[model samples]
Target: MSQHLPRWVLPGAVITVLLLSWSLAVHFGHAPLMPSPWQVVVALGQLAADGRLVRFTVASLFRVSWGLLMAVVIAIPFGLWLGWSHRAERALGPALQLLRPISSLAWTPLAILWFGVGDLSAVFIIFMACFGPLVVTALNGVRKVPSVHLQAGRNFGLSTAQLLRRVVVPSVVPQLLTGLRQTLGVAWMVVVMAEMMAVNSGLGFLILDARNAGNRYDLVVAGMVLIGLVGLGLDGLLRRVERLPGLSWGFPTARPSAAPAVARLRLLRNP
Candidate 1:
């Protein structure tokens, strides 16, 4: 019998190969500005030694958390409303469409002007970055909910609010999770940019300060690496959430051909 490779093997191998190639290229090319992997590791150690690493990381995450919370509270319900009522969509859709096309970066100056150069400005920028994708995903997901599900919800005599709560929201959670995952990436990016100009602390500020203060490209690379690692962890968390029993409909597990077919479909929204 042949054995398949472990799930993590391929990805680990690819990353190992890339790191090795990067180290070799920097060694042979003698690139002065670019830091080798080991140099970046040392830079990370330096950051940790000074305690700036943890502080910066926490600051960035705090702003991102606030922004994500704000977007979810505001955008999800608005999207649901737009999806549920054609009249609401018609009235609000044009404005939403107009703003959705605007880049989050475009809001940076205005954010500073309105919120001032602080945490609020940074959070506002991240919120703007995350808002559009979340709204769009939620709207589309609600629209795609099976009509039968809605009809059954009504048959049970659930009130409009109850129907939306027990019916529509759960129905769209999978898509919303995907939106959230994507928005997490956007939030990280925007926060970093916002921090470079708006705030005095964070990984973004660390990177900018390192470069400006001493041309410490190693610290810059280290900051980038940290961002990538954190982003990957967050994405994986959302992926795991998608596979949770409550949202299994969003991410069904594959069954082996040798096993008997068994559908353990779970509908958490069922009345």
Candidate 2:
């Protein structure tokens, strides 16, 4: 029997073909302003040699960590309450749903006003981007907790706090991690937008500055490549966490993720 080709093969071939085509097109089209893949690589080397690459990447990461941390501290508890109590959900659902439709970019103006033109403003923007998905993830996960597990805990004479610790938290961990993975990606993307106007040093600012200063498209492309690679690295790390023992037990019945609803919100905001 013949085996199928590996998943990486197709994608690698497509990328190789695209690069060849791009180089040919640029050479023929006489688009001197456009940077070929090799030119982009050279530009990336220049940035790395100057230490700008590490410095800018770290600055962006610092903002994302702070913002995501703030969101987790607040959203998880609120989401738990909303899931465990029908009344709480009914009460706060409308307000949160109203806010969910607003894109993080929409809040950039207010974020700048509230936090000023600094790292704090960028961090705040990332927080706004992360909060809603995490809440939804927690709420959905809590709702999916097996009633038998809850009953078994209660029958063992576990108190509310004990039951929450032993039962609810473990049950929710898998979904929460997945949500975090998605949220982290959103936070990374949001940081670029957050950096564009209110910050002097970040990959986003690097791209913008490159464009304005002598129209250095090579640097712009290099910055974009770095953003995508870093995002992929983050996702790979999260995937490792997902594969840890016991996390998969919760996936037999995964929660309906908030991503689709969030996509709809983006549509509404953009339209």
Candidate 3:
């Protein structure tokens, strides 16, 4: 007769409570900088009605997707080679390590000059963000494949190419997926930052534009919520893909139960 809520229920309830608190704060705090949740909702609806929101959202998504595609094409093969061969690793590792510490923001000025203040610049920044993480993840994943697995592949008469295809690739899949999730999230973030600096037609630009138009706090708040929602949606999609049967193994095991089952088992054994 007892009701046991699903695992997600408590988190959902917590979020609802937080939103309510935020709404109340805006109403009672009488702060102009902090608009009520209803105000944000109203602004969001207006943006949707006006159609600029869709255009900017799509533009941002487009920039990230293009950059991510480019990164995948270049990073995967280069990473695989570096991971599989010591010569390639020696040649590339120091350079990659050197660049890893330099953020996408640091490259923005050069990207702006090289590509100009346009979509290309924004996409280039996203590319830089995606490339390094993807390469590092891919290379680390591949390099970590167990030698015993490779030996088993040789035992099964796999040639070098076959071994790579059938063994190495499969073994690193979980890591690849993990890296991919991180890469895409970073790609999205870079897209927003790049748009703010270089381009005039994305969500980030919209936020800047709203801020410039003076006291369009509603619009600014709306834009912030939209970005959060879009990022959440993208991550949710990735998580769903990761839960597919082939991909499920990539995730770590659920936390272990701590009940005293062993004590009960011992009593049964004695009886």
> Which candidate leads in lDDT?
2
- Tell me the tens digit of each residue's lDDT in model 1 across 154-267: 655668897787767776888898888888989988889889999999999989998999799999999999999888888898889989987855322243221111121123
Error of 3 at 148 (Å): 0.8
lDDT of 1: 0.84
Which residue pairs come into collision in candidate 2?
none
Candidate order, TM-score descending: 1, 2, 3
Off by over 4 Å in 1: 1-3, 250-271
lDDT by residue (tens digit), candidate 2, 1-271: 1258887888799989999998998888877899999999999999999999999999999999999999999999889889988999999999999999999889888988988899989998899999999999999999988665666566566678866766677779888999999999999999998888878899999999999999999999999999999999999999999999967545134443444333433443345
- Candidates' C-alpha lDDT: 0.84, 0.86, 0.80
RMSD of each: 4.9, 9.4, 8.9
In candidate 3, what residue range of length 10 has the lowest lDDT sum? Answer: 250-259
Ranking by lDDT: 2, 1, 3
